[model samples]
Target: MSSTTETFEQYLHNFIESDWLSAIHTLLPEIHEVDRNAVQIWFRFYPLSLFRYLQSAEDLEKAVQGFAMLGRYELKDQIDTSHHFLYGHRYWKTVKAAIEAEAVVFENDDIDLAEEIRQLAAMSAEKLKIDVSLVIAIAAVGMMTLNQTGLENFKNAADGIQKPTGLMAKSPDKIVSERSKDDSQGVFGFLKTVNKKYSIIYDEKRNDGRFAITSDQEIAGASALDRSQNWQEKDSRCWEGVIPVECLSASCGTCWIGVIAGQEKLSEVSRRERKQMKVFGYNQPEGERPFMRLSCQAKASGNATIVIPPWNGVFGKKIYQNVQDVELEPATTSARELRKVVSEAAINKAE
Candidate 1:
């Protein structure tokens, strides 16, 4: 298994085996009070998130309401109100234990005991995803109650993982597959059958496109394109004056392409590809899977269609920096001239 897949599986296994299970079990009495269907749906997508929150929660009412908030209000209304009351009651039981054990402290020690009951009612706001915005909102509420600077530290922490775009979107695999199929048929109809069986597709019409492999295939020798001399002529279209490749190694990202279809079908990512893709800036977010890859590095055993990027260039970092500088350049000519003079002076001093 690829390290990425192995790491994910290990994470899941560790969570299952650790104190997380004990924490969830402790929540059973409270969880039972929630609408059975709502609880089931919430657990499906957010078992880990809920478990983590429960283990850390300062109060029981807040903990129970937190999980309930994961479900939409419209759906919650469909369930029995008795279930909701029971859910709240059970959650508070755990919260009272946490407070008694000194796991979480309240800002106002003097507040009447009834305030704790009211706090649970306030926690039913239905924003899920537990993203930066949610974290910021929680901090804001804490600051309002505590009259302190806790929100600033929380904001700084959230900023580290925030994306340039607010949306946490992933590329659709089916769309990629369809594009690969269209491109392959348009360029190399005769090679379709062979290309389908293997993960890589070669198109001579585009930049002398050579072999394209799926992300997961194990390459023999140096790279995926490397083949024995006997099979080289028969397997490689470049040998038949079809698609030409200058270098078979990653030195040339020439074989870069968008995964047309079946990204899941491709091999799980490797350490080398992960590093190289970052260097190339093809994969921007740390959490995202790369959509483009070097064909020579990626090997596919199953069917996948791919579309080649128009051009390949090394020195990706320099290109990215230059683009950013230009975009941020001052609008006035005077500012531009001053910037240019300062840049020249810095260069001369370095030399």
Candidate 2:
């Protein structure tokens, strides 16, 4: 395994491996207070959506590349966050099915298949209560192990309850969160004391974690753009350590960000922001606040952890293909039945 893969593995491990019910209560006390079940259910299946796209990869190396690509693009556009909230059990079953489909179980004389099954049964029996997040992590780790090694190796590792450690973090490839350490000690440090500023942690590869904005300030992406202006002046299109921003007024979809934490503390999504998000095809109007939000539209009221996408494009209305209209023949059926038939006919015609 490469250092890049190892670093990401550790990051993923730290991000999802937790006693989530307690963790959510700690990090998002308000959310847990109002609806503890909702928060707990959401975090339980968080690993499912996080690891779902990786099922398509043919090998461990490709899976790492897929992970990196996911940081850049919204790959699973069809599966929104609400699906997990409403149908977590079904969603998790599907994820497990995908993983099992990709995984290969050995059936050789040297490997006791029955014993392996019994061990797996014992493990499941031990944790009968729904700690779904840990179960998913275990399966995900097993899949990664199978990819790097063979099925027999995975069985052995699983039997011994040993996590597969393919690669170790190296000095040159250490994933560090970049923070502005000089902010409090500079000549302009006094200016920061005037207002209540909150830190925004960019949780992507760049890990640009030092951008701070005053209370009720414009989104974190804008702050990042201001901080990186010198670099932008050097190269107008540079986005090395900056959150990509084209039109800061929420016109372009270039500044969409995923709120990994502190979402509730952020200012409410405005009417214009909601409309623009729908136009950008990044959000649905089903909820007041969503995990996926336009950074330009979302103001930071407190510290937030956000993930920036790799690329952006305008596809609001363009995502839909042209549809042909159809005239239904008059029938003796009731109006409701006729309308249903017409709808079915139109769908069939579209197909």
* Best TM-score among the predictions, by candidate number: 2
Model 2 global lDDT (CA atoms, 0 to 1): 0.41
- lDDT tens digits, residues 111-202, model 2? 22223323332344344553333233223323333333333333333221112121111111221112211124356655664456677765
The RMSD of every model to the true structure, in order and in angstroms, is 21.6, 15.8
Residue pairs with backbone atoms closer than 3 Å in model 2 (clashes): 72-310
Q: For residues 203-288, write the lDDT of model 1, one tens digit per residue.
A: 21233233434224532212334342443354332321222222444433334445534444555566655554433334322333
Segments of candidate 2 deviating more than 4 angstroms: 1-132, 135-194, 204-208, 220-222, 225-241, 318-351
Clashing pairs in 1: 60-91, 60-95, 176-260, 176-261, 177-260, 177-261, 200-212, 214-300, 216-267, 217-299
Candidate 1: deviation at residue 333, Å? 46
Against the unseen true structure, what C-alpha lDDT does each candidate score?
Answer: 0.32, 0.41
* Candidate 2 displacement at residue 203 in angstroms: 2.9
